[model samples]
Target: MCVSVCVSHGICRSLSLCVYIYSNTHSGGGLRWQMAEFTHLVVVKFKEEVVVEDIIKGLEELVSQVDIVKSFVWGKDIESMEMLRQGFTHAFMMTFGSKDDFTAFQTHPNHMQFSATFSAAIEKIVLLDFPVVAFKTPQ
Candidate 1:
């Protein structure tokens, strides 16, 4: 599980604190025990002018076919072109119930098909997988 706090403009400080605690307790796991953690944050970048809707549809289909993905989020970077240059046009935040679930996602046929579709529009892709450390409050 993961917790994301919005620190964007106009968010109240108290509300942010409340959300922080809620996110940590629910998404990041409660004080007693940790929830199932994911081992990676899979991010994909597409070329400019690519059909985003089609890619999202493909991803949705892939997710439906694969049981390994416990939860996920996909979206385009709406910040700026400079941010886009940093890397990745589309980011897919996926949570696996276990390492085994991640492994299954790697080999799943639907994933392979999705990759094929994704590659067609994407000029480049960057994949990063990080090991999970102890959970902390979302910054």
Candidate 2:
């Protein structure tokens, strides 16, 4: 059996939230995700007087240099609804192919340096990770 995976713009197009991947043909052509992915979700509230722009830029640059980072996104809170008071003003979502990849990204020198600075400037944060068991998207 052989598989043809889709890679778009260096991103595994098949590896987004709730999306499915197909590979390894049986008697009929089909696809499957060879491995599950890990998601690292982080929310942070900057301390007073901290330069939020610099922090975001540093984090973006740090993750870009880590080869294990399959996908990464960061942004400020949208503040759409009235009950959206989580206090964490920024969010980051990063996906990795495996725990090893996640660890590699975490331990990368650039990440280490960023963490050192981020830890000091953030007043509060919430970090959570979980394996993506299933993902779905609407048309």
Candidate 3:
């Protein structure tokens, strides 16, 4: 099972100890070994005036220019009952075969350029990198 806890800055020291215990028991080598690959969930909150079409256009242009992006899916937020409450207006789910592939994407010039272009349109952003643990169904 995967779990995450977001903590405020002041409580980080105390929360980190709890995070460490949970991570050590739940996310060690044995857990990591079960994954097929990992994915980076790039969640972005756009400015009020930014439309979904504009975001899609920007992402299409961005992905076309980047080589390190193995595969990606970009979309607007959907209604959900989950606690996260779809805070981000847009989401880009990108998959990489390995950590090296992801690292290359992070440092690639194309990505940097894209970020420069896209950052001005965003109000807030959050990125969560999660490992693929136990895919019971075939991809």
CA lDDT, every prediction?
0.62, 0.72, 0.63
Kindly indicate the candidate among 1 and 2 with the higher lDDT: 2
Can you write out model 1's per-residue Cα lDDT over 11-121, one digit (the tens) per residue? Answer: 222322212222335554544223334555656666778888888887888887787776678777788686546766677877675567788788888887777777788
- How well is each residue in 1-139 modelled by candidate 2, as lDDT tens digits? 3434444312346534332344555745543444356889998888989998888888788777887888889888776452674577888999898777787877788888888999999998999987654322223
Scored by lDDT, the top model is 2
Badly placed stretches (over 4 Å) of model 3 are: 1-33, 81-86
Candidate 2 wrongly placed segments (more than 4 Å): 1-11, 14-35, 80-84
Q: TM-score for all predictions?
A: 0.62, 0.71, 0.63
> What is the alpha-carbon lDDT of model 2 when measured against the actual structure?
0.72
| Tens-digit lDDT string for candidate 3 (1-139) | 4554434223232232112111233434343223334589877877888776876787777777776565788776677544675566668887665667788888888778777767888888888887555413232
RMSD of 2: 6.6
Candidate 1: C-alpha lDDT? 0.62
Clashes of 2: 6
